[model samples]
Target: MASPSVPTSPPGPSPSPSANPEGFCALSPDDPAYRVFIDSLDYLTPEEVERVKAAVRFSDKAHEHQTRLSGEAYITHPLSVAGAIVEWHMDADAICAALLHDVLEDTGVTKAELVEHFGQGVADLVDGLSKLDKIEFASHQEAQAENFRKMLLAMARDLRVVLIKLADRHHNLQTMAAVRPDKRRRIARETLEIYAPIANRLGLNKMFRELQDTSFRLIHPMRAQVLAKAMQAARGNRKELLSRILESIRAKMDEVGILAQVFGREKSLYSIYSKMEEKQLSFSQVLDIYGFRVVVKDIPTCYLALGALHALYKPVPGKFKDYIAIPKANGYQSLHTTLIGPYGTPVEVQIRTEAMHHVAQEGVAAHWLYKDAEHSGADLQIRTHKWLQSLLEMQGADSSEFFENVKIDLFPDEVYVFTPKGKILALPQGATPVDMAYAIHTDVGNCCIAARINHELVPLRTELKNGDVVEIVTAAHANPNPAWLAYVKTGRARSKIRHFLRTVQNEESAALGERLLNQELHNLGVQPAEIPAAAWERLVKASGNRSIKDVFTDIGLGKRLAAVAARRLLAEDAIPIAATPGSLTIRGTEGMAIQLAKCCQPIPGDPIIGSIKKGQGLVVHTHDCPVIRKSRSHEPHKWIDVEWEPSPGALFEVRIDVEVKNARGVLAQVATAISDSGSNIEHVSMEGDPERLFTRLHFTIQVGGRSHLAQVMRNLRLIPHVVRIHRTRLEMEP
Candidate 1:
């Protein structure tokens, strides 16, 4: 059920300011504003009012000896915050929670006390509103990030938590004049970067604009003052222009027999300044500073008013937006257009029904503050719930990753695109097909390999634009590639990809580590499968690892060494065998934990040696590899004997440089020869100039072994245009 709406009738007189010894609010309780605050609460039931009074009385006691930087009683701060929530006509629990939000954080009171007095609902709200105390962070950024995470997690549980928090922040911003100058600037910047965007996404346009303007004023006082003066000066000069435009739109609406309310609207100073800075324009170059909103009685009349305005003034092409048809993700709906006004100046106009106007201005709060006769609060609540759920799903991420994703979500300048079924999907501006696929379904996103945009097949990284129809082509066996993380824009896609990669990488590393450990154990005449459970448990404790698998996984990932583990395990055997020379073998099943050195690509046909770098697992190098020569001079003990298993299963990378005559199709011919030799060229680059009658071509090809690479080179040398060919090794020349 929806919360009660604000009553339309004016309330009776409230108690005077003298009613409380400590201040009831930042302003005198007798002030007209404080009276309006209490009067708005008259709609609440008597029991609810009593609960609110109890909370206020308790908080007033808790903060009895405390005062704010402005010299007002600390209790007055929570009173103002509660007053703001009251203006929104929030439920009694919200108002009560707002009153006691800081009690548990700043006073001797506890959460249990709040629960005993106001119930668990109000206690949870207050706890959610309170900051984490007694925690020391290495940096302020870390502290802020953690604090935001805590609040968001609470909000995910109860939406009221954020509602009260936003109100609290709003009041704090209002009273920021009393804060230290440096601290004020820091808070204002954070409010603009974090809170303002959050308010905007929540459809709190009033709060969003107020936060932006207030933050901008503190962050750049001189710039804000200059912009304000410039706007005032322009208002005087364009007085007649704006007046005529409003009159003309009003007359046009009247001619169409549409009952409308029209008024001149000036863009906020910060908004104008942002536009100027973004577009790199001077004050005079920004033309959309003057605008008007026309609120009609119903939806049909909204379109009619738009038509009337268009008939009277020519609209700037491509500047018209029909948000009414495709409401924004925040449930905002309006028809916006920029028209060529009198004297060829541009004037922006918005047309929406009365209900739309309220929703556009008040956002989520409008459902409660206004009756919302057409739509219930459930609609906005559901959308907010979905958004919060996504945030909660991201809990698997660390603080930094979660914070980064939240910041990305805060600025969703959405683009509306169509699915193959013609269903419109709204995504952020730079969202790619990967993000779109993920939005459809998690499975579809994980298996997506290609996309079709406007019926043309394109790479998955292709960015989607508004109005484009996109279709994802998925393969059942396909999995997410690490490269996709670079282009995917949405938080869901990014988080999902990272989560999948982390899981897969761990599993694979563990498996590879197990094999390496087994080999090491076998060398010491110990069968891995026959190891005692007690022995494994003891080893786990000795290694300070969570489990036997974690020990192997870390070793496989080059974080530890299987040899060290094997020595430790064998040390308990009481029987030792002489070290077996050249015992370990490679079967190419080690996954990413074991890598073939790119300097001298080792294949089955080449003698190879393994070097266990500190953090990089076994690196295989050719026995005669120059890199081994350089390494052997230092940590020769790290080098170990390793032989390629008979019939290696995976392909190895080998570079070949071909000197060929510069001619058309020559590069293609070389590529075809390599392909005919049953090798795939992974990369190609040209070095020598074509105009010099010859060019040097470098090809990095995937081959089975040395024989396969030799076959590829022989095939290339058969070409009549080929001058010379040689295998390329990354070795420094003396």
Candidate 2:
């Protein structure tokens, strides 16, 4: 059963509707809509109200020409927004802020005006809720994430900010029907996916339910209608079954002397539909459908109530959980049990104290809901602090992965496992041992090689079960493989691993570029100081770089090719190299004439290519040509066509020189090793004449590409007869 946060009061929020007598035609400030608008001022003082009103009036005047698709005045949106905050029982400041929410956004009314009128508190809320107003995101996903991050910062400061924003969203969701269909669906989807979840977390259950149902109706109307009808039909047949189940549980609790309030709980249609969609379950197969929660007096009674329920019903052995003993980081506590009820049917039961029930439903909002919650205990406060801080910490994290992790972590279906020390940790249904490793520590993730679940060796990808004892196995030298990233599900693991790899890549890139720079500088016969640091800065900017490190890193990563930066730097110093490497070649004109080089027979997939020549080697093509045409006159030497023959058809001639121990069968073993890789030595020479005992062997062999040659060299190096092996790619020194 889902433990949504609930407000602690005796349901004060289904407030009676106050009356408004005057009609719109009278245009009086005393009208019902205007009165409700005025009533929203509970969060503000009278002076602030007047100031905010003046700002709203100014905004109304500015937006006078703008109208909504519903044909209502644009001012109606702000009024509706104000009404939403009022309904949230929020303080007057939020109501006034909501009224001006659009003023700074849709009209020229500025944040300055809002601050001048409503004070900085309300003004800050408006500014936080407003669009970035500049710097458009690259895509919808990026925009959604950026906007969510902004709201989270606001929420971290003041809960009422999100509360009011949710109310504003509620009103808009209600009015979304007036918008165009495509736009309506998009708006409804965002509201359903994000705002409703926020409302649920805050314990604004009414808004949460309504927003979800409304958005679902618009986004998937056919599925919505189908689900509604199905639920109705299911309720009709199961109404008696539900009542009997509730009675049995309540009677059992009473008999056990556990006084509690028991009520039948019905899952939301959207939730049921989502569960079905996710798990591919039929509505009837969705076993948690018939849950009924027992709200008790205290934590001890919660356990007693659970025992009583289990006595009355057959407990589903592994499905029981006791989060109350070790509450979640979000400060939720409850005893959960799934049982085989009458007729061997499955049903879930949740038991929690009044405080836990409230927190369960209201989440972070419960810190404000209960009278003494802030002072209740240090543990609750610490947990709440951790919860808020976690959100802030997670905001700097890669959001796409963070949201996914949160969904799985907060998902209604959870499996609670115990650490070796009896500490409890809740993981999603399919989380693996590696997920647990990463949860332990980022270094644990870096060194995780395998896991021992309950002291039995298991694969890193083994899915975890409730109550399983898991221990991670690590090697001192182990490191994260890119492949591990594919199977890792949790955001913490994914983000940590990605961060590790990115850091490694950056270090490697810097190191690699440093090496290349030294080599290139040496080739130029110029001291490193020949070009001043200022010149490097200018070269970076002329090449559109934010940092020299960025430029060098890009060059190392092949993102910014070496030739571009080399030419830029060389040209700035008035060096002799061409302005660009590929400017021209001697042999070709602006023509389609190109031919392959027979020397290397470099094929497409051979990691093969050609280089530009200033005078003679124009349009240097690889043995297998593909580039069909080129700007021949454009420093025609720059052009090259490349290809690779499949499997590198012929054995490559390379010589390996090794210093050997001169042991028995040394020459025979080396020859056998070379031939083992499908290559034969055509010639061999020995150094260190027979008496000295130390010897050298040079074997000429055939092989494929550099990889095969490396393998052959490795095999020969392992032989006892070989002390060292050296091979080099032949190149002519300038």
Candidate 3:
């Protein structure tokens, strides 16, 4: 174990890419590659250095007979990857891990043998980096997704895993020219979508920028070449303008009594191209292609430099941000401002302390690289750890959900808002009050009924803005409304809400299934209390379910019919269908388990009949409903005779389609008609031929039963300009 010496800050400007546009590629051992790797380990203890040397020797020996597609020794690939880790000044274990990352996947090396030779730390890192190729997958996408999930989960546990993986990907991308054209495009797409974003989030700006440019070259070579040439031309033309801006900022800083390091940095080609495409602008219109960073001695000096720069030129309103007051989630802190420079050009500038500059560039890796950066770097590590832990918390989420969450985290264009208690909370842009509540806590989200933004009552879906103070209003009885899913921005909020809805739905379905199964059994003269254990087991076995409850749940969910399950569990000819028929008692309290068919909403006096849905419990339909008429011919055996009880209990929903003249007050008038008839409109929809003067308005109204609905319909027919008023009986609209 060794605490490596801190590396000095890298130079301000990037070298010309035209010299080696493919970026870093593997070098032969006869060249400076091995020496460079060895020199990078100078900070390691002698013992640790010996361990790394052993890993390098083992990897070289294992790959002695292999060669890369570029006709270079295979060992050079891992050597190059290890060189990257060493450059990052990673610890001895990470260095060793980088050296042997490909051994397990590409060679005949076993994890057990690696553990015995290199110790568990190195072995575990290699294992995490290994792709799961032994297992079979149905498609390439499936295998890719599963492996990505595996890699991400491992990275969540050990940040070094992803660091090593990123290094591996970096080298692979650097040498992508040797890969087949089609395969190169696939790898480039994955790099652009996944690896590049991960590097950006970790604050590995160098890798992030390189990966993007490399992938852009591989996937769209012509476009990348054109952009590169354009950038080169722009560099020549803008050199004097940039020089003037830098000189002005330096003079202004001197006057303000602030000592700083000011330098101009060009945006990466991919970055510039992305901005142009996003804004639908030409290259000339992209004014912020070149930005300046002013590294001051301390935090106070950063603001002083910013003020000096702002005073030198006209500041672009709303383009100034103080990240020092509210750092980014990645722990980057700086003061960013855009000013109209020498020729009315928008010049973007960032001001930060020297330490902030390092953290901004190196991100979490700075913690291990720079001893002096430990405090701020550790703060970033803590933040990163918390976010990773959130990913682990969502481990039970399905693959699609987990992958979607990772994508959501990839691009965090955040808005910083204040809570009522003065604590700041960061949320994605377009986040609403419900998203705010969920970000606070799941319980708070579940109970949230209303919200007050900036001390004024606001709708839950109101999008929050930066600096707005948000206060959530919760109620004891309030629960998550499914409508919240439409506006929530965070994956956590969406997942939690979906989990709740799914759990509630399952429970309701299971309860309904139990009630239906019991009623069907009773119809066969088998009382619920009298059912034997063997019968339950038999039913479970026949349905291929794990337990009796699962069978009930499936039946209730409309995947199975209760009568069929009951018949399977009963003895042959135990009771005739007409012999001991028992009636199903109805109560509106059935919730989601039992449902009244919306196609023909049946009321107490509507002569109702039950149809055993495969997964859904009994669906009660009016006897003459057209849905029943159509389904009876195809599924006659599923139909069950039923009658509503004297006390139907609770409100019944019925659909009414009204044809009305396209007048402004027609909707209001129809709503008034239903309201005045003692019926509540649950939902409303209006649509019709735009060329015609009449429109079709459909309403789902709540009432006591069929008689109540009839009266409401009669009252609607009497309204002026109401051409036709009729109940819609089709289960689903055509």
Candidate 4:
């Protein structure tokens, strides 16, 4: 499923191109080497062909000095991709864009110039394919993730964008031998996992096949060549077997009143090797030989043809899929079955109407020509839009998550289920109901509570399967829990949940901001009306914001520092900075008596001590005041004179502690005596003994002076459970 399998066989007689292209697909429009593109222009309008011709002319001129590895003009590569676009029936701009896809990267053509010449659509398309090298990342993984994210976003805007990109990659991969070996391996590995699968999803079967084959050749050149030789040696008999099978099916269908086209499909080397490596199968065990598609006239005839096919051969059990009823996510609808033939050999058969055949092969590309087809019947437009919407959803997702989801969704294996209304929904295998919910509607994903799979309630995590009728039960007030993100598999689900979570987080944080602002206001002891409008202006100006809302948002989001905001607001003359004990000292309440304590110094950590001077109402200092440091420095107005009190008769509170045991009820017993003495424990500090036998406790308590403190100490000494207790806040020997 990870391989570049054939999504659709080439319709008419045009030979399907190899997935990993051949050497530099000789794309020069002037040259006859790549006229296959013009010959394959079976679906292009006259105007579209002219646009392609114009693209070729511009590309040839721009790449005048450029040459490819095979000594061909560089324009060949763009022309090569443009040719593929013609086959896909992409719009004229897409064709032109494909031809000029590499212009901004390979040539010096600016996006502006391209827009001026070819229009914005073509320029944007070319720009989308252009690699991003402007930013530096710490790792290649990060860079790759970002690049892929950019590509998907652009492609989501326009599917033709990625189409051009895929075409560009296809040509480069085909000619990767011209690159260094290590580079070749990187490109091949990336193509195998990403580009090739995307090709399959788009139903560009020819491109997908060639991409896988080319990757196998470059990535596993030895194995690829070996497989090539093996297929070569064994091809004669395989072709004979295929011919006999085709003849049998054709004759049988003719007899059954069903006209069908049957052709043999040889599996690509990448696919065969993948089967060998992934499943540990032998080459013979790998069924790469059988391929026959039956194109009928209508849907009922398609089912009829399946029966006719089964009538002719015994279908290998567990290998049948009815995609016609529940088409693939890419709008592919065919009845695929592996059948046992003569000699017990296995062959894969695809049965569909001619319309489904067009969709199966063209994928989204079919949308371009589907309505215009002479025998068109199926609703290709609707299916294409559905897949297109998924791509759009993927594009809108978190790029980091999208990268992971793409690895799963783009691969070929998929599961199709049915709604109770009989509508079919296709999803990747292992996708849960959450993925389905997201696929249905973003609202459904948010409100989904439970799901009934086939009329029985099942866990949301249940893995769905083909034709399982699912009904989702929803609640009006339901919301997406962030935890649901852990189990999500699709990009849409992940993105939807993340978006919800982000929205909720923002709302919660905004509420937190209001609370924080109110608390800070309370701490400042300032009534809302007390702060003058002029003062608010100065503060807001210092904060560098024109409005308070901006300030609140900044603080809420952690964008602005609290201390900086406080400092800016306090810069006004009316509001002065006040120091707490062991914290910065500043003036508060003019003429207030505040002294610096000699014990704790009130540097930055202490609870503040404030004493009213004779005329001053309040003076602030360190509670366990220290000897003076510098009184003033750069900001003279912010500083206030403070004196250090040595040993006051009043018991000066100080912080002290000792490491002690963490026995049960130890803290309770220590507090019992302090409660008994009726002295409040102002500040207590505790630390755990890592050795598991002790605890450290520090306390700053209100003591009446030395004599009163002595009485308190004597009381503390009476407690037998008490460990060592100190009375001083400063233990520094200096």
Candidate 5:
């Protein structure tokens, strides 16, 4: 039989191998396509090529019964994927892994078998690229998310996993015409949303552009057709102009004695479409559709070329960026500037050394492609490793949450900031000092209280700007505020803050939960220590908790009633004893587990009760507060007697309504009185018509206790234009 037709090559720079040799129809070791694949492995040793061929033979046998939607032998798919990997000049193991990637998921081949044949390194690589298809999931989205998480975590361990995976996806996208339209759209969306961004993040520009264009075409075929036609027309119209600019730049470089290769660059259709969709611009409104790239011999020559070009054309102010000085997070380095071309048409130019060009084009792949070149890909490798290491830091989040965080990190419009020591840190745009602090270290982030931007004190939430020298001020007593979640931009910072807060909340909840449970047990005439270990284990099992701590945490968070849990922990036929008199005590130091009810604003001196709110721990409210009284009758079982410690550890917030004349200075006078009484106004607002003679100024102030709140009110009574002052309670009885 004639050899199966070679699969079509994806949209990339690599050339497709010649057609299969005659009389080599079936998948075999002597297949000409396999020969071409092995020939392309010139970077590998002779022994390595033999190893890769062995893997190809093994994969061929394993997939002999499988066929793709295009009716081609399934081995052809792995061969195509391997060809893409070869184009990247990846090592022998990567090519071997690519060849055997689908074996675990598709065939009966085992990881151990692969290990025996190719050793542990190749086995691990293949395992990383394989999906979790054997496991059941709740939904398609969950399965997809989990697979993505698995692949990413694997990629974290070995960056080659992603390179191989991207290649596999690229080949799949190229052959996707055989897929159903709905599935095609889904794959296209996934490619555009996740894979393309990942390729861009990793600095695989060529692959990134190709993935984007193909996905865009599949997702919006009509739009792509229209845009392609429009772009073609625009290209034809601008050809002469682009030629003139290129010639002028070449002449200028020669005149300045700067040896440079200047070539005109056309923007990809997907890029043009994205620009229009993002900025709501028409085709003609997008000015930088055509640009030029100047590749020079050295870094100094790159700057010299830039000067020559600027002299040749009028440079546009504020459109120049020196990424060469501060490379991008992905280790891309180039100088970009926009200029006024002939007839006032805009022209964008990029200047970079030959080495930088390789990096700009290949990104992390440059590390392998140019491994033997004079310019070692060490910088690119380090940058890529740093980013991959961060993926490891993002563990502990659930699958969906992990996927979301990674997506957030993938699309970075970077802003470069400097530490006090002058080390540069690249963060996503809109990143705050908190992100910078986290970028420095997790300890610094946890203890950071404020920042000094350019040596001037600023809020921690201040958005970092390019070239700003930031100094984070940390306090040992400081802890991450939950509010940081609203402003943090980096996934690392967001995840770190969330993880710390969760830990603190869990610990506080467990402590409070134990106290609540013990109180209930005492009410039932039992002591916690008297309960045996077996009873504890049974309680944990019955409560659907992993451990006794989890059971207490559930009770503390109000997910399970402490009274019911206490009863379940004891024997079924135990004798009743006399009830206890003490109630659960509140020290006001329970962190997030014990919260003061906003409506009642209970303080230490108030006769307070606790309401066990689901997922919100215990909410303290004054006994006579109308808000609590309304809900008291409906969920009486949730309400528990709570007494405040003689000395509560923290200040309590309470609201006071001050009726005053509608004068500008009257409000300031009341605030001054509260301040003089050693009370802080957390918030202040006005009610009623401000134009009227009388208005109400509401103040939410933090005070020590009931006596302190009374003192502040007494001070407010002494102020001028203060008509009446009373503590504000939500819907209280007169």
Candidate 6:
């Protein structure tokens, strides 16, 4: 692809140089920082350079009165960010956006002004990097989450926005010492939790390590200091050993007629700290603190180098991974192996082509840095684009939920699995077949009924392992189950499932709500179809709802009372009769619109009442339930008469308490008896002291109704060791 270009322009007037007593340079053309920033743009065409200079001048003018906490001119921060962008070989527009990024948020400059001076592309990039500071939020966390969501969505549209934002965060972290102690810690925590992980996800290893180490130092200064000292001492002790290993690998590669560039790699302090923390190991126990990277001419040479190294030292079994064949989800490719070094210390080695090395360090940025078709980061770009597109899929979620899902996606310790057709799919560790189905497509996920691993039927919740052949069996009528949410590991799967469920719930709730409202209107001597549009407009306005459907949804979700809504929809003088409303019939298929109360376990043929709960829809309870009896007196308006349809569509779960003798086979006998009675045990728990001769076994079982429950109790009582058996009712204080 051809590179982006910009128009040439003459330089604008320069501000006079000034300096503080502490030697901080003011905004000026003569500033050393500005000169260095200009020098770094050497890769850009002269015309592009001039355009970037224009942005610098504009930013300098806009931030003339502002200064950073470090006492330097505020323009220096943007200049530093732009310098990083230049180093990454970003196009002229990206550089300009970097210079003007803070102007929209920190100064009086508007996006319109940016567009007038620069271009819409530059203005959009700057706007994307800006925070939503002008809007009100419920808390600081919400504000931050919202700002992050905005930036990520913007990044989905233009990847340069994140590149510029990451550079901005990098500069801020570099000068964080001037910030207050508490503020520094907070910024460091956010950086470690969000930004660093994002950098890693984008395959920006160089930036990722720097961000992680800097944040670690700021967050835990003492621990960082101690770890630094230890690493330094360890480095000195291992220098000679690393040198010997490097020489041996080089000599072996030469003997095998393979050309390679070998160098020792030092582990970052944050990496060491994380290893120690995660593995519960002492400093000395952390092996492979130093490793080697072998960059060769081609893919074949990479494998040859790996073989040469293994021949020099005994290879550690189960410590080798060939990522070149199945690259990581982030598109990192290499061959890695651990070996016993000269003194038996474990030494890790990585083998890859020179092009892979550049990608391993620069990640997606390599697309700009290395434009050659062979060396370009096209694979990484494609992977990144797909992930960015998923951000759009997750847009309808709340800010906090979106932020959380993105965080989960950023940390993918992946396992590579195969489809039946031989295509490979990478998923997070502990991911289930549902995650795989979703990764394929949202429609596939919605219709997946079961999965077969290697042609053997397996549970949909089974955790996928490396090299497993996962074939999802989808049916047109199948739908995602709420229970799948408990085991699905990928954020894509989780968000997709939630979005589908929410969509279904809204539709179901609206239908149920309309029915309830219509029943109420009938009792009030009004027909829903006969209600005028003017009345609906008034009802929507009075209820603070956006539309008639919204009002119905509120009533369905129990946020608004259907009776009150029905009265509001009628003309003021229209109500004349005061008749009792008929009980609403529930067949237990209301989906999210109606929930069966666990406290009472009301089944078919039971006298049930419905309680409207905010955000939770209607909850059904047996009329004699202790919880209902206690709360009915306090909130009579929320209770509505409900009746069961002659044939309820689903089984009801009921709890039974069985006291049994402490015998080896007594629990099994009781379970078998309940099974013989045609009841399915949902859960069973043993309570009371084990030493007692008698213990209570609580069995939560699914039954058809009260008759089936009675049969189950009788069967359990027939067990020889059963002391007593009865249906259980749990009561809660009002």
lDDT of 3 by residue, 129-220 (tens): 99999999888977887788788888886788898899899899889777999999999999999899888888877788899999999998
Model 3 residue 692 distance off true place after TM-score fit, in angstroms: 7.8
Candidate 1 deviant stretches above 4 angstroms: 1-36, 136-138, 178-182, 373-376, 540-547, 563-578, 581-603, 606-642, 659-673, 689-695, 715-726, 729-734
**Lowest lDDT 10-residue stretch of candidate 3:** 6-15
Tens digits of per-residue lDDT for model 5, 637-687: 888889988887578888888998877788778878889999899999888
lDDT of each: 0.81, 0.64, 0.81, 0.66, 0.84, 0.85
Backbone clashes, each candidate? 0, 27, 9, 39, 2, 0
Residue by residue across 409-435, what tens digits does model 6's lDDT show? 886489989999999998999889999
Reference-based TM-score, model 1: 0.88
By lDDT, the better pick of 4 and 6 is 6
Task: Give the 10-residue window scoring lowest on summed lDDT in candidate 1.
Answer: 6-15
Q: Give the TM-score of candidate 3.
A: 0.88
Better of 3 and 6 by TM-score: 6
Model 5 regions lying over 4 Å from their true place: 1-35, 138-141, 372-374, 529-551, 573-581, 623-636, 658-678, 689-694, 706-734
lDDT of 2 at 378: 36
Q: What is the lDDT of candidate 6?
A: 0.85
After TM-score superposition, the amount by which residue 511's alpha carbon in candidate 5 deviates from its true location, in angstroms, is 1.7
Model 1 residue 293 CA deviation (Å) reads: 0.8
Candidate 6, residue 85: lDDT: 87
Residue 635 lDDT in candidate 6: 85
Count of backbone collisions within predicted model 1: 0
- RMSD to true structure for each model, in Å: 4.9, 12.1, 6.7, 13.4, 6.1, 3.9
Residue 121 CA displacement from its true place in model 1, Å:
1.3
Give the per-residue Cα lDDT of candidate 4 at 95: 76
Write model 2 residue lDDT over 112-220, tens digit each, in one string.
7555545676677777788765767778777777667677667666556676688778778778767889988998988876788666644455567778888888899
Q: lDDT at 156 for candidate 2?
A: 66
